[model samples]
Target chain A: MWAIQLFNGLSYSSILLLVALGLSITFGLMNVINMAHGEFLMIGAYMVYVTQHLFQQYAPAAWFDSYYIFALFVSFTVAFFLGMLLEMGLVKFLYRRPLDSLLATWGVGMMLQQAAKMIFGAPNVAVTSPSWLEGGLQLTSVVVLPYKRLFILALVIVCLLSLYIYLYRTAAGRSMRAVMQNRDMAGCLGISTRKVDRITFAIGSGIAGLAGSALALIGPIGSSLGTYYIVDAFMVVVLGGVGKLAGVVFGAVTIGVLNVFFESWLSASIAKVIVFVIVIAFLQWRPRGFVSLKTRALES
Target chain B: MKQGLGTINRESQFKWIVYMLILGMMLLAPLFLSDFRLMLLAKYVSFAIVAIGLALIWGYTGILSLGHGVFFGLGAYGMAMYLKLEASGGKLPDFMVWSGQNELPWFWMPFSSFFLTLLLIVIVPMGIAYGLGFLTFRNRIQGVQFTILTQALVLIVVTLLIGQQAFTGGSNGITGFKTILGYSLSDPTVKRVLYWITIGVLALLFALAYWMTKSRFKRVLLAIRDGENRLRFIGYNPAVFKAFIFAVSAGFAGIAGALFVLHVGIISPSMMGIVPSIEMVLWVAIGGRNSLSGAVLGALLINYAKTTFSEAYPSLWLFLLGGLFVISVILLPRGFMGLMKDGMQKIKKRRKREDANENNIDFTFGESKR
Candidate 1:
């Protein structure tokens, strides 16, 4: 029971972390809170739904097993390009004013959700896991974990690792770090902060796309699925300490475990209430977030 | 002393004119509009009250609270609980019974009395805002962080309400309210009276808020908005002031919620969701965030446009709203009031320039004659 619960918690945390990392990167680096971040995830899920339907109808039966992989790539590309377009057209101009960005993006989010409803209909779309990833791995008589969930967990780790490398090892990564540290100083040093911002936003949105693809495998897709995750993603960003990768991981795991344990003990609603109470308490202690940025000047 | 006395008399006359105008309008509105339109206007008046509260906080205090819908929701639910109890008349509300609740919950008993429920409607939201402000402001949370925290609060409250279907009436929310304060809500006469009462209350609240803005306390709020650190250096604890204003704002929002329930006869969770909260902010932004009258006018105009546009072009309304928000943020940062003020200034300048040109022409002609 403990092992199964642990696995469940980790898988939930992995998905949350993936979704929140995009928000954190955008918020932490650009100081812009993209309230429409969840819509990106929703778009990715819709893309997967469409791709899966197309593949099932047109492709050979043998290629169906690898459809999930194809969906992820397609969704990522679509969301990434869209993210770039959004950044260039809207977000870039609103960099200095974070609060306005929040409101504007919220408007954008509503438009996207309404558009999705108009196109996809209001009902939730049905998605199926690949045949190999279906069913559970039975460890004992009362202990079973879904294989798809385990796959999500593995995917999270791989994605995080690649993200870590891309953020730390590459020259662009260094420039991004510098810009995040001090935009004016980075600009003075000849760094193209605009280029870095666009790239970072695209990558962050791509991760959200990946999260959406994973979410389709786990549950139903709908126009407002993003709304459900948005609050949770914000909580993760807040709890993890804004702008820190490690904080995102920690926050996700803590919230995931607490949610599962509380749901087991109490009703789901009560568990969510308790989680929010905990987050409120946590915020009271560290308003800036769990991990404060290294530069003291950025405190404002 | 004579000049001061004259100024005082002038101000009093101005106030009387304004009061009489409001009284006349309120008395005359119900005569012209149908009951349905009267009810909608009452709803708009309630929203105007909420917008007034928002103006006090966002316009005066420079704190944009994204969770005001939570306060509105709490107030609505508080009144709904009372109305539902009265509707049941000593039995459990239908939803509770449907959820297998045999007895009335102990906490819900206080709301049985209309007076106590009205008191709770104001108190509950105020209490929550006070507690939240005490925790958040003291910790120095501001900017995007504060905004996100408020959004989280909205989410938690909304999710809790939705999930606790038995208690909150779930996604459908509490409806079917038949009466308020023993007055039949469905009766046209009763609704017309309520509409007058809403207008009166809104006028009184607006007057009080306008007076507060002209007070010394409001100066401190503006100071804090401009430079909290500087205000702190002058020995004012910004958190205390922020908390006080937050509670006051929530109190007004609570009253608006109660008024809203009276007018609409139904209160849904969606009414207090993030969307509505953002819309409230937009109203203030478009009306002129720094001006009290602007807030009220903005709320009425925007809501009117919303109803009209949605009715005319339901499919394109979202895009229009989105575009409005984007355009207002980008171009009309100071809002309609600012635009009006700027226009007035430009006219005065042009008039002065014409006077200078006329003087130059006259002087040159006179010199030629000499």
Candidate 2:
């Protein structure tokens, strides 16, 4: 029972980690909070639903099941470009004012939500899982690890690995980190700080898109799906500490475990309240968050 | 120096005139409007009370609460419990009986008395605000962090209210109230009385907030907004001040919520969720966060526009609202009041320039004659 619960917690954590990474990165690097980041996830989920319909109408029988793979790439690309557009059009102006940025992005989020409602209608639509992921791995009569959960875990690992490579092994990534650390020094060294910001924001948004696609595999897609997960995603980021990759991972795990544990002991709604209360209390204890980086800069 | 003093006196006189004009309009509204419209106006007036509280914290203290709906809802619930009990005539409320609750919950006992209910309406929200402020502000949590914490608080309160169906009437919330202190709620006279009561409360609270803003305490709030660390160095506790102002703001929201329930006739969990909470902030944002009158005006104007727009073109209202938010943040950061202030300054400058030009022309003409 405990083993299965742990698996359930880890699966939940993967989705949280995927969603929060983008928010944490952008907030830490640019000091801008994108309230519309969840909308990007919604956009990605819609892409999956769209792709499913398209494949059903036009694709050959053998190629139909492979539509999920194509949907993943499409989700990332669409969200990446949209993120770039938002960064250039709106975020560029409010980089210095985090609170204003929050409100403006919220406006953007509202518009996006309205647009999604108009296009997809208000009701939730389901995407059928591929036949390959139809069943679970049975460890015992009472213990069955769903293939869907395993697939999501694997997807998150792959995303984390690629993000590590992009942020560490590449020159552009180095410039991005340099800008994050000290914008003036990075600019003086001839790095285009604007370009770095644009790239970083786009990448973060794209990751959210991937999270959306993963989420679509687990549940029905709706216009307001992003709204449901957004607070939880934000909690993960805050609990983990912003800007630190490890912090996000640890935070997600902690929230996920606590959530499952509490749900097991109490009713679901009560468990949710308990989780939020704990996070708030935890914040009171360590306002900077777990694994927070000590910095010489006063404002940070 | 004399001219400057004269201009200041004139400005003060102009401000009083504007205040009186608005006050007169509110007082005379029922004379012109139908009963239905008057009731609607009363609802908007209640919202103005909440906006005033928002202005104190967001505009002056620079603390943004994204979950003010929680405090508002608490006040509404306090009033609602009393109304429901009165309607039930000493029996279990219909929903509670349906939920198989044979007895009244212990929390519902205090609200049976109208006087206690009224007091609790303000006290409960203020107490919660103080507790939340104590927890976050003492730890020096500010900015986006504080905002998120408040949102979490909203999530907790809303879920608990919904989940405890037997106690809170579930998602439908506490409703079906027939009377208030034995007066029939459906009676037009009662409604008119309530409307006048709303207006009185708004005027009294508005004056109180105005006076508070002009006091030395306002300077400390401003200082905290500008430089908390500097204020701390000069020997002041920013946390206590922030917490006190936050509690005071919650008290105002509580009053607004009670008045809102009295006018609107129902309070639901959906009303106090994240969306409505954030919308409360937008009212202050659009009205002019720094000005008290602007906050009231914002609550009235935005809500009126929302009703009219959504009524006429339901599909387009969200788009317009979204666009207004973006535009207000980008171009109207100081809001409508700030724009008016700028326009007044421009007119004064243009008049001065014209006078200087006339003087120069007169001097040239005299030189030519000589």
Candidate 3:
């Protein structure tokens, strides 16, 4: 029973880690709270839904084995483009005013939810896991590990590695890191901080979209899917301390484990409240969170 | 200094006159308006009181709490508990009984007394806000992070309220109040009196807030808003002031919540969620942040529009509200008062330039074209 719970908890944390990565980068670099992130996830889910429909209609049955691979492209490109558009159009002007950006992004989120509702109708939309992705690994009696969850776990690891490589190895990543450290200094050094910001925003949003598509494999997708995860994502980012990848991993695992343990005794809603209280108490003890960085922003 | 004091006295008298005119209008409103409309105004006024508290913290002091709905919810629940107990005639509430609760919970015992209920309503929210503010301020959690924590508070409270069905009446929330202190709530006279009470509280709180904003404490608050570290450098404890204002605002919200339950005749977990909390901020934003009159008027106007639009066009209303938020933040950053102040300045300038452009076709337009 403990193993089953642990496995489930680990997969849950994997999903959380994916969403938190985008949020951490956005917070650490842009310092703008992107409330519409969840909506981007919803858009990704819907994109997967659309791609699946297309695949069923025109793509060969043999090709159907790899529908999610195509779905990934669909979700990522659409979400990335939209994120860039949002940044250029709205979020860019409000960079100096974090409070305004928070509210404005929330407003944008509401509109996105309404737009999704108008397009998809006010109901949960289904996106099926491919046939081969179905079922579980029969480890032993009472210790079965679900294959869908395993797939998610495997995909999360791959994405994390690719993200690390993209962030640490590439020139764009280096410049992005430069911009994150100090925008004015980077701009003076002849780097187009504007381009770096646009790319970072797009990639962050794209990750959220990918996370959303992954979400569809486990559960039904709806306009509110983003709202549900957005708070948890913030909690993870906060508890881990902003700008630390390893912090996110640790936070996710701790939260995931705690939630599972609490769920055994308490109702889901009660468990949620308990988790929130725990986070609050933890925040009280360590306001800068577990991995506090000595940044110029922290002094203010 | 003498001349300044004289002008201040005259300005205060002018404010009193404005207050009287507004109060007179509210007092005479029941005669002109239908009971339903009057009742709606009463509800909106109750909301306006919450907006005033929000204005005190967010506008002047710069602690943008995103979870004030929790405070308001506790106030409503406190009132609801009393009303529920009164309706049940000292037994468990109907829902509790229906859900198989035999013994009366100890918490529900104190709520049986009307005065005690009111006291609890004020103190509980104030206590919660004080505790939260102390922790946040002591730890130096300010700005965007503090706002997010408050949002988390809303989620937590809402979850607990919804989960504890027997106590909180679950998602359905505590409702079906038939009377208050033996006065049948169905009676229009009682409602009118309640409306008057709400307006009375709102006026008194508004005055109190206005007075605070004029005092030395207001400077400390504004300083905290601008830079708390600087205030500390100068040898002042910013945390005390922040926590105090937070508690005071929470108290205001709590009273407003009780008045809200009385006016609207319902209090639910749904009312205390993130949406309502954000809407509370919207009221201050739309009305004119930092202006008491603006907060009150903004609350009344926004709620009036909300009801009218939602009733007339349910499908389009959410879009309208969302669009208003985006437009208000992006376009009208200072809100309605900012626009009004700008227009007033422009008019003053126009008067000075009128002699130069007297022959123009359109006075306002031609001045702009020049």
Candidate 1 local lDDT, B303-359, one digit each (tens):
989888888888777677777777777788778988987897677556645865887
Predicted complexes: DockQ each: 0.54, 0.65, 0.65
Query: What TM-score against the true fold does each predicted structure earn?
Result: 0.93, 0.96, 0.95
Better of 1 and 3 by TM-score: 3
Cα-based lDDT at residue B177, candidate 2: 82
Q: How do the residues B221-339 of candidate 2 rate in per-residue lDDT, one tens digit apiece?
A: 99988888889899999999999999999999999999999988899999999888988889999999999988999999999998888889998776777788899989999899889
How do the candidates rank by TM-score, highest first? 2, 3, 1
**Model 3 segments beyond 4 Å from truth?**
A296-300, B1-15, B350-370
Binned by DockQ into CAPRI classes (incorrect, acceptable, medium, high), candidate 1 is medium
- Write one digit per residue (lDDT tens) for candidate 3, span B279-315: 8999998888868788888899999999998899887
What's the lDDT of the predicted structure labeled candidate 3? 0.85
TM-scores, chain A, per candidate: 0.96, 0.97, 0.95
Point out where model 1 deviates above 4 Å.
B1-23, B313-316, B356-370
Supply every candidate's count of residue pairs whose N, Cα or C atoms clash at under 3 angstroms: 0, 0, 0
In TM-score terms, candidate 3 sits at 0.95
Overall local distance difference test of candidate 2: 0.88
What local lDDT does model 2 show for residue B210?
94
